[model samples]
Target: MIWNEHIECMDREQIEKLQSQRLCEMVERVYYNVPFYRKKMQVLGLEIGDIKGIEDLHKLPFTTKDDLRENYPFGMFAVPMSQVVRVHASSGTTGLPTVVGYTRNDLSNWSEIVARALYGAGVSKEDRIQNSYGYGLFTGGLGLHGGAEKVGATILPLSGGNTRKQIQSLVDFEPTAISCTPSYLLYLAETLKEEELLDKIKLRVAILGAEPWTENMRKEIEKQLNIKAIDIYGLSEIMGPGVSFECINQCGSHIAEDHFIPEIIDPKTLKPLPRGSEGELVFTTITKEALPLFRYRTKDLSSLIYETCECGRTSVRMTKITGRTDDMLIIRGVNVFPSQIESALLEIGETQPHYMIYVDRVNNLDTLEVWVEVDEKFFSDEIKQLEALTRKITKQIVNIIGISVKVKLVEPKTILRSEGKAKRVVDRRHI
Candidate 1:
């Protein structure tokens, strides 16, 4: 299922050589076309000719989201509006949205990379895919849609929400694959079970991304939906959902190094870490035509692996993202990630996957409370049983995260379900 085997499985030497050439060209393109990048390079005492290859990538100045916002619309674009054919942007909760543009060639290349991602996740023309990601401004829908088209798969463009229609399409269309956020997939599973349509559909593969999910969550999704759950990694700031993807082996997600060069660096020191060392992930777009970025800091924490995968793709792979540095919750001076809590809850195997973390300040001290859902059958048990379960959960979380948390057990379907990325935390301390 490896698309573009020649590039995906290229030798390390060939890959680096091709990357070096593209990197040099990208540097030159941005230097003359984008003033922001040119100024950043000049400030760092760099010229277009100075960047000869990917080896000198570390010397280039890193681009941040603030830089994009400071420039506002189209300032980061390397090509003029006449040559740009499409534009995609991140969902900016505050201030202006980060803007990105694409040339005709850029969109075409985007399709191919997304196709490679879908192929890596075992999608093909024979499969009917139900894409549940949203359309319009959101990159997830169009990104997955283009890739599905490139793979020649039958597409049911049922963008996110409307659980009833999604289930109806699943039963009626009988799609063999699906794409959506992992949490939304779980929500869909719940609805399908309620409607008794889980067995009517024929889904064998799920291309899930948009947020960090743990292995336990993957297993829960697979077990509930009766499908192979594969993780796809990407960002609108970089490329949508096709940056990298896991092969059937599921060892790690193989990065498309021939296009996007990835580097893991210590977030504190801003120094590149050796492979397998966890740090902030950074990417440089060497093939993008409309908007070329130099060492864009993704702020995601993950390590890389260069060992050729069992899938036979020589493209270097990244481990599952632990969490975003911005998303880390510091409670009582101890750092914790929502994914870690989800993993612990799933490993305990005593409650449903639906849960939420509440962080607040009590008497000037940070407090953490975890609300978990239990099956109705168990929830209706004697008071002592629920109390024991609560104690067990509190103990388990403290043991794993090194922070004492008040555990609240609730009935099934109490917490709101999300058809997109699940909102896992309610931090009122800032408010």
Candidate 2:
């Protein structure tokens, strides 16, 4: 799988024809191998031949998280359990995790896609990659590790946590690149600063993903660590972290068009949205054997572009996810994302980076509050000054989120620091 030479550099017409051919085969394979899909097809009165190509893809029923949950462990799997070499699961905060399986060929295919992403980002066989993404049920660690190895990269498989150990590995290994969540990398940068080992380690690129991050955050990390921070995007349901990645251009992440077909649709109506339109990302796995999902609604909000990228790849480009449709919060009829609050908080230079959002219902009305940690160096004993600082943050939040929020300024380290997905929202009303 030398990166599928013809597919990578194909013209628009050629790519479309290849995708159409692959889609028809995948749909037929799913109908025969997976009972869940067969039942869905039966109810819809659809047959294998009906879906002759990509155009018929829109006719197929969309798969969702509920479908995966309904099937539980193996009902949706296209291959037998004995053939499955690995299984990865979702975080499962809501209920039972959505599980995904992979055969040996599937794993190899995944590695190839991931390698393409790495190669596009300038990672070559000679480089050493330090992987800080967690290993296990989560796909980040192993997904990236396998790809780095496929590219002949010497990998330092240092999973997340243990800040001291992570920094030690960085110094000892002196890897040329690193992969992990953006927030965790920021935390690592802070730790490295405290240890005064920033200059000793050598890293040119940092592949960050798994959560939504902004260009502002990217600039901050780049400045702190002195590395070119590149954005890599993927979901566990799709194929881990190599579904798409930003090439050298840094404009947007290029989706692996040949393997996973990308489509944008309105989350509410499920109607197809036009290209370059921001909507929920839906994917149809074209060549996947173990689990070929047809039109799986990812709920991730992004836009799609199908033009030649500056990086010279014909693969489609997807904008960085601003926020997930499911994660949106309704506060007094105003829709908001935690990232909006974070962006507002960052603008206020007075407060520290540590902050938490709280929502409560009082007399059937929602109330918003933010707890912002104050740096010890900027701490003042006067209550009036602290109140003034809080007022400034409150105004900033109001301007950004269009909702007035009470800001509480506390001492340093008052709020906990999370290395994984940051717990920014506390909805007492939901409880």
Candidate 3:
């Protein structure tokens, strides 16, 4: 099936008209088939007719992760189990994993959206993609796998882990693109550098996702790995990593608005913010059938712009995520977010990506500690060199986080292993 290039290049008025039409159809379908939407509409004294267009979307109640949790398992599913061809769940970080189901049609639509995202990222049939995102239960691996297949790219389904083995596969398969967490890509670069085989690997593009990273880190990864680093944004609840992706311009990720509607709202007030205003990102799935979400608050903080992209895609664009509202760690009455520390760490230019923020209370005072993993070149048996490095990192952390931190320089592999999202904060404080 061919995508509408015209829709992708549509002007503001044209995109809005198309979105309004899709939103109206989505509302009607959900109201009729999904119990959750019916209940929400009834409580809001809303009828299907009331939601005439996209403007009336504000009249509908917003959905959230908590709401998905409240109706655990298949409560939010619009279709029966027999119709659901696939099921995936969140990581259950907050509570029980919220399950999402997809019908065959939904699966097909998902593939199409993902394919468009890849195309927007400059991936084509000639490209070879090595999908390092973990497969099974997790949607990133399979979601992108299907998209790669749809685009007719040779897919190397090397789903995460075994650094040496991954490198071997790259050596043999010679994939042009890779997709995984940015930190893991750095891990691969480190492994390649250790084996002195960095020059042997051939990769043109990288699609990094599932965590918030800075532009500085992007340049660092690109420089070390010798590939164009791009950010792909999505959550399992919102239909995996292909929801949006960065184009060659790298300004912001372009949302597949034809399938999913994007909105930026004030995190606290839940009011929609104007374009270019930074706020929490929200999504409303317009094409999903089994579990169509309406105004689902993603809680991720970022800005959105509707201007035409240099890549010629008319989809609304979102800036790189600054920090998640939930991921913000309150340390010593000062708000500390991982992205801030990430930016600071990248600015330092000496430390690697493997660093942990340790927060503990000492004598009724908050004590912050940063544990940074030392590279092989920096590893020293001499105590003076180690102490100097530690002191330098400690002072930098204090300057950035506004709290003096004890910097612990650990061995190369002393830090904890992160199979999924990297753990940023290790807080023992009881709040």
Candidate 4:
């Protein structure tokens, strides 16, 4: 079931050797071609020769989102604009967008890694894939499209939005696989149920990412849609949606270590953490030609597993992302993440996966309020019963997140649906 066994299932020592060689070459390329990287290395009194192998990766300065912003547009690109064949940019909600470039070889490699990801999800050429990720400046759509084509699978290039058309194509095309954000998939499932077309479609595997989702939510997706849900992790700064993926076994997502070296580091101290310790996930793209990044901090929180998987891939695996360090919210001296609230709500089983967290300062005290969408069945319940359910959810949140939260049980579909990454938090204190 493995694809590109030479790289995915290579011996651990051999894999490290390959990574070491690639790392050395990448460091040299950035040192000479990228002034930003060269200045950072020179400031540390380090040279290309100093980075001999993967062992010396720690010596290299970490690349942050702010660093990418400072460079802006094509400034971070290692190759000339003529050599770059493709460009993708982040939404840049905070400020200037981080732009990434890809050479011809980089695109091919991106396709290959995405192909490997599809294969790990039990996809085959016989299966038709519906790519629902956004297209254009976003990487998810084209990333999955190229990967599906690389795998020799038929592709339906139906990007995000157009819910009616998305469902129509699903039933008409009867695609066997789908790739999109998990929340969007849930919305699609709701649409299918509403239109009474769930049985008409033939979707088997869902490759979901672009947002951090909980396992409880996955089970709900599986139950509602009657399909196997697999998590795929990627960011636009890297190669896109094919960075890593979950196999059918679903133990952990196997990293494409040959192209991107994975590292877990303590976000606060910036020191490498031991394997299996939950910390910030970092990546260094050694195989990229147009834009080779050194120790790019992803801000995602996850642990790494180096043991061989039952699926027989020797590539290291990463646990499901818990949350982003930057996304963590401190309310009333308690650290909270939206994912924790999601996990708590989904664990309760009576509410839908759709929920929102609102944080504000009330009377100079930080307060947290959670708005949860309840199933239609719950809406018909007695008024007292609904109040009891709200109390129950409040207790669960307090127990799980160690903070008191006011729970509001709203009607289903009341929460705004997103075609891309879901907006789960609304911090009003800043306003």
- Name the top lDDT candidate: 4
Poorly placed runs, candidate 3 (over 4 Å): 1-4, 328-431
Better of 3 and 4 by TM-score: 4
Candidate 1: segments with Cα more than 4 A from true spot: 327-431
Worst 10 residues of 4 by lDDT: 89-98
TM-score of each: 0.78, 0.77, 0.76, 0.78
lDDT of 2 by residue, 1-431 (tens): 23556667788888889999999888888888888889889999999999887777788999987788788877889988899899998633233567998989889988988898788777888889999988888788999988999999899999876778888988998999999877678777878888888999999899888766778878889999898898888877788889998876789898888889999999989999888899999999998877789999888889988888765678889988876777556554344667777777778776666888888766434688888888876677898887787788898877777657888877677687789988888877542
- How many angstroms is residue 294 displaced in model 3 relative to the true structure, after the best TM-score fit? 0.7
Whose TM-score is higher: candidate 2's or candidate 4's? Answer: 4
Candidate 2 global lDDT: 0.82
User: Cα RMSD (Å) per model?
Assistant: 12.2, 11.6, 11.7, 12.1
Instruction: For candidate 3, give the lDDT.
Output: 0.79
lDDT of each residue in 278-340, candidate 1, tens digit only: 999999999998888889998888899999999899999999987676666645423467877
> What lDDT is obtained when candidate 4 is compared to the true structure?
0.86
lDDT (Cα, tens digit) per residue for candidate 4, span 287-367:
999989999998888999999999999999999987677876645423466777887777888888899999876643467
Q: Mind sharing the TM-score for model 3?
A: 0.76
- Models ranked on TM-score: 4, 1, 2, 3
Ranking by lDDT: 4, 1, 2, 3
